[model samples]
Target: MKRSTTLISVTLIFASIFSAGSRGGDALGKDSAGSENPMRRFLIEDGDPNLSAIIKHIDNMYRSKSSTSRLKLIVTKPRNTRTLTMKTWTKGEEKVLVIIEAPPREKGTATLKIEKNLWNYLPRIDRTIRIPPSMMLASWMGSDFTNDDLVHEASFHKDYESSLVGPSEDPNGWLIELKAKPDIVGLWKKLEVIVSEDGRIPLVSRYYDRKGRLARTLYYSDVKDFDGHIIPSKLVLIPEDKKGHKTELIYEDIDFDVPVPDRTFSLSNLERKK
Candidate 1:
């Protein structure tokens, strides 16, 4: 189904929250000098040394068993701007449900993703539509991000080869480049990520398309301690080609590893009136 770019923004923004959490996570824990670090011990490769461990840590920074959150999404263009308020629930690696609560015209609209399948629910028409794989690259809510940008299951540690880039602007911090393996097929030919020296928080990430052109830039800011998990509370996405266009997602509240009933992800819940 074709949707307004603004509406598409809402879906993709929530996807980012579930998948990237704006790249937030617990700080790297240290053990005794001779003890092995969980983040480094298991994933460390003999050839890459600390690079692999660092990438793995950054990739799984927001890893959790389950979560629920409320957030605001703003889509801006040269001529207009729109805002959407939404709540989302997630369990494990799959099962995500997102519902729109504000912008009355679109209230009660929802999206559900279980495993590899995705569906959209339109409250106004009371119809539930399944999103085909072909539409994965289509624009979501007219935002800078596409459908796949939110739900795509590519892994940084597995699908891409990572290497450190020296001479970074942040002293003591690191700039890492991730190039998709030749055999892996997906958007983003490469990624350049700038991580803070302390806590290893991801400050900014630049995504490059297949033609080696800059596709978009994702900026993480407004670091906040949510309960105990320290993570950026805001994410701004800007497409390289879209002038005067950007999408902003501000997390208002979140509960990690909380009890989200399985029924919360069912079709009945997706179609429920809010």
Candidate 2:
């Protein structure tokens, strides 16, 4: 397949969806009211006090004031395998910029997401194309993930109602169930997440389609301590219906709560060479 075709088909996933906000520690973070961020009024809290805390913890895990990282994406198939290296910059939940670094042909290609808008820069043609809302669910870069996954348009706390599913022995963690709220539009109707018992790190998440069928599974591993924060450095995503197909995202380096200039997320910077 042509490099352009592959790049166009590839969709963003791990970085925006799972990367930013958690502060690793013993106590759960607080909400705006200066209280614990968990759903205290929910019945699930009565059954497992940690359930709500875990949900809130994981929801904010990858979030930070600002962050920067270099990642390696490996997409594997039955007949072919390809790799790409990229550097990413993010500011809070609003701005994100991803620039390809390796594979000479795609070296300068970039994607920018600011608030609700997303755009891609193709260096080869010196053109910028805006991604419409209609393509939010489209697969990115020929991968299993979607465009929405790239920009993180959905929030677990706001979009899904969660419940405690007890313990999981296989991964040795707590199982949490999340069902989509009827009002929100998303590809996954439900999700099952296994969170590590110790630090509440997400170990595995199973995505279920609208029909309640298992669609894909995301496995998080290789825990690393970045500064004071503990996070999974590697993530592997596999679709249930596809054989010998999977995408592995490995974090090469990351810095959280770092300084990021405003222009870094601008349209002009999208065309700037790395």
Candidate 3:
């Protein structure tokens, strides 16, 4: 019943994809001012097309201004179980670093940095490896998520060609599903996003595989207003094939626009830690 390292890695990679901020619906119809379509105005005024808003929505969740909760990752399967605690810090588009700590027998710590390049440091090996392109699809740390899932985070306005996918509903309000561009790289071929009509916060997303089959579903729950932005504090990921297998991520704390040390995301920093 033991899983291969590759399988474990894949699991972790996919898990991170679900757990991380990387992961999007649509509707049609008219405007209150009668000058243009109401829905279109809503989309523009809400800054849906603004890259800053989209990036801020995802990255600002881990800002350094205020103390935020540490991130805890629990990976479970029929045979293997692992838990990881991570502290993350970001500096503009130039740097991002995540320090990982795992307890018990593996007391080792590792640092991952994404700058102009990507690299990882292993305390045990005491070496830093520049991630190769071929390894992008490889599972991360014996989990289902791929390494690429972490490094190649997508932007809505740049990475996707979004359009209305019709109407949907959730606890947040009415929604519009958006489909990914056909040529976009990644596992998901399409996404169904539920945006709160009133709040303009994303509530839920349904991910479809390349085969056009429903592959996974992600729910963004527990909406909290932070710095004039409505953010989701809790996320749940459910697989289509695995009935009982589910992953949940709860943000312990979040901050925005705080100063992070410049060297915190350096590759040398990762190497020095090892």
- Residues 102-161 of candidate 1 have per-residue lDDT tens digits of 889988888887776777888888998877766666545445886665656556788899
Instruction: Give candidate 3's TM-score.
Output: 0.67
What local lDDT does model 3 show for residue 66? 21
Clashing residue pairs for model 1: 5-141, 5-142, 6-141, 6-142, 7-141, 8-140, 8-141, 9-140, 9-141
lDDT tens digits by residue: candidate 3, 64-167: 23222356656566565566566556544435555565464333454444543545565676776655555555534433343544445554555565555434
Which prediction has more favorable TM-score, 2 or 3? Answer: 2
Q: Against the true structure, what is each candidate's TM-score?
A: 0.83, 0.83, 0.67
**lDDT values, one for every candidate:** 0.70, 0.70, 0.49
Off by over 4 Å in 2: 1-15, 18-49, 139-141
User: For candidate 1, what is the total of clashing residue pairs?
Assistant: 9
Query: In candidate 1, how many Å is residue 12 off?
Result: 5.5
